[model samples]
Target: MLPSTYRDLLRTPGAAAFFLTAAVGRVGIAMTSLGIVWLVHGRTGSYALAGLVAGGFAVAEAVAGPQLGRLIDRYGQGRVLPPVLAAHAASVLALLVLVAEGRPGWLMAAAGAAAGASIPQLGALSAARWSALLRDGRAAELPSGFALESLANGLAYLAGPVLVSAVGAGGRPEVGSVLAAGLVVGGGLALAAQRRTAPPPAVTGPRTARSKASAAVGPRAGRSLVRPGFVVLAGLNLAIGVFFGAMQVSVAAFAVEHGVPGAAAPLYAASSCGGLLTGWLYGLRRWRAAPRVQLVVGTAALALGCVPLLVAGSLPGMGVSVALTGMAVPPILVVATVLTEATVHRHVLTQAFTWLNSASAAGSAVAAAASGQAVDAFGAHGGIAIAAAATTAMAALAAAGSRTFGPPAAKRGGGFGSSAPKRGGNFGRSGGV
Candidate 1:
């Protein structure tokens, strides 16, 4: 049964439309990387070139995400998404055409890069909308909203690979790319159509004399990346990304090493199931712990969870360990979303969220390469070791920056349901940085 909070949230005007559409759009985003890899490899018969092209796509998306998010924040979704989605569609078509013609690998990679650079950050944008909708007295619903978003992401991840792989197995890998492209454009446009729910663009007009005077007196504010606590959050998420990348490779390698290569998918699915279950449950209750404290504990738990992976000699044992590890991920992400919403300026909230996504993408790309090397040099256990090391670094980073994260709701004299002051609401600690 759905929780009342989730039911109530979906009942909000335009909520169901945007959420449903964004969920659809994210499935496309999830499909693109694997689709590209399959298409390229099938066409060219070179895993090396396929991986390079796919890696370039990921790196381009990570590089472009924050800048695109900043534009979305400044111009609003209605004004920005249409053109961006159009470009994405066009670039994807170009990629397909280039591949069909047996074009040079570099040309195909460039086309993939263009497609990736324009992929919308739908999940982050949806999160920003939830923040705007659930503000004031409805703040308690924020966690549930974020949890639903995380679940949507998980579902998309699961569906995308299956869909792409199934199509590829039928001997037309390019069809998967086409399907992903269509979904990305269609879902993005659907979300953009929900203009009523879109957050207002940040006011970037000329500063008034009084505001200018204050700005002159205070430290000059820059982008969200430079914000005090935000850097720590981004760093922690990067490490979490490393854990994800390493864990994926390690589990697959372990399964193959034990002569049960087919077991890899089910084992990873176990981790996903654990994450979805915990994320759903985590959103159901309001915790008294500070966001910072939750983050610290979450990272610590994740670190401990990864430790078991290093020692698991059997598939069943590894499944249990991976599931435990997956259980820790969603809560950390939920807390990170809560904290980002609380601390970032409302104007740049979407961009702030994108920065975290970008960080994770960057980390994942790096870890995938590093873990591949480790797996080659020292076998499956080496990859597991890398996963554990990443989580430990994440925990250490969380502990070090614990102080910068603001006090708990109790200290602030309010709980999750409490409203912020109207003038400079808790939405952004703009001056606190």
Candidate 2:
């Protein structure tokens, strides 16, 4: 059964609508890269070209995400989302047409880039809205809300590829691409329409020192990327991404080595299932540990969990190991989100979250290349080793810079890591879970 916390969250007026829309949009976003690969590979019969196209798309999105996020933060979601989504839809259609007509690979890649550049950072935007809605009084609910977003992300990735595969089974990969495009456009528009839920445009009036500093730095200066806390979080997320990318490739290679290539899907699904279950559980309880403490613990657990992959000789062993590793994933993300919301100025919160996403995407790209090389040279074990090392790096970073992740002194009382009296609820109190 769904927990009461989540139930209460959904009961918040306008929450259910935006959450559902964001989920749909996120699923579409997940499908896009795979959909591009399928479509291009089907049309060109060249895995290399398909990979190139998909890589271009990923790079484009990573590059453009923070900038788009800045615009959203500055102008507000209702004003910014519509035009961006429209561009995304148009670019997707262009990519589909290019694939159908057997256009040059570079041209197809360009279309994909256009599509990627316009993709909305819905997860980050949604988190920003939650911050706006709950920060004043219901701040304790923030972790649960972040956990729910992370769960949505995990589910999207888990289901997106399967849906793409199923939809493209008829050999018309373009159909899946079309479906992905439709969901993104439709969901984004619906989310935009929920104006009441969207965070207001950042007020840049010269009322405070921060605002004055932002003004001094020029219009684009208050970007979350410039902050040290954001940098720390981005590095941690990048390491997490390395773990993800390496795991994906290594698990497949392991399945192939065991002469059960099809087992890869189930093995990977085990990890996702584990993450989903634990993410829900993590959200249900109030924790005594600070967000920084939770982050360090989560990263350490993730590193240790990957250790089993090195020794797992059988498919089932690998599944168990990956599942354990996955259990640590969501809590880390939830903690990161909490810390980000606490540390970043609310005006730039959306940009901060999107920058984290961009960091993870960049890390995934780097890890994919490195893991592919390792797998080719040292087999699946090499990739698994890389995964473990990445998580270990994440743990090291978290421990070394734990102080940097602390919320501002003022926010500590009612939010994460506070010992003060609870104003809204017991969600952030230091105690049992």
Highest TM-score against the true fold, candidate: 2
C-alpha lDDT of all candidate models, in order: 0.80, 0.81
Error of 2 at 195 (Å): 1.1
Residue pairs with colliding backbones in model 2 are 288-430, 288-431
Scored against the true structure, residue 77 in model 1 reaches a CA lDDT of 90
- After superposition, the stretches of candidate 2 with alpha carbons farther than 4 Å from their true spots are 1-4, 203-224, 407-433
Report the error of model 1 at residue 69, Å.
Answer: 0.1
TM-score of 1: 0.90
TM-score of each model, paired residue for residue: 0.90, 0.91
Report the poorest 10 consecutive residues by lDDT, candidate 2: 424-433
- Alpha-carbon shift of residue 42 in model 2 (angstroms): 1.5
For all predictions, the C-alpha RMSD in Å is 4.9, 4.2
